[model samples]
Target: MNALFFVMGCVDGRLVLTLEETADMLGMALQTAYNQIDAGTFPIPLRKNGRKWVADARDIAEYLDLMRKEAREAHDALKRKLAA
Candidate 1:
């Protein structure tokens, strides 16, 4: 019954991060995140859980971290090219 406990990985169960959190973490729009889910690029979420889209928190965090690292590297390369 305690949603807050889920955020800290305290519950002995799977945690679902909201689409908004996922989007914010990836620095992307809500639609873009939905598209990835729709296109099967991102992990599919659980269904109709009373009104919220439910995705594994671990998956969302991992995907965002990976994408963030890649984006930063790409930006660095572009900066180097411009500086050269």
Candidate 2:
């Protein structure tokens, strides 16, 4: 997970990330992020707060962790295959 996300302030007792922050975390354009949200294809769930979309910080962190674990496992499998 990104260190920037960890330092984000909380809103209403929950650590939530703005749409821009979520886009940055995912390395996508702001417009792309909006499109993904509308299409319901974003990896992390989001909800509209007033006029903007926000995602739970914990959810983003968990998704990142899961992606990292999967990538590491795939790399290890490839290495084992090559060694054999």
Best by TM-score: 2
Give all TM-scores, in the order shown: 0.50, 0.80
Candidate 1 accuracy as TM-score: 0.50
User: Which ranges of candidate 2 are over 4 A from the true structure?
Assistant: 1-14
lDDT of 1 by residue, 45-77 (tens): 434467766666666555556666889999999
Off by over 4 Å in 1: 1-14, 19-52
Please give the RMSD to the true structure for each candidate, in Å.
6.7, 3.7
For residues 1-84, could you state the per-residue lDDT of candidate 2 as single tens digits?
A: 653355354333358889888778767899998788779788888889999888887777787778778999999999999999
lDDT values, one for every candidate: 0.62, 0.77
Q: Which residue pairs clash in candidate 2?
A: none
RMSD of 2: 3.7
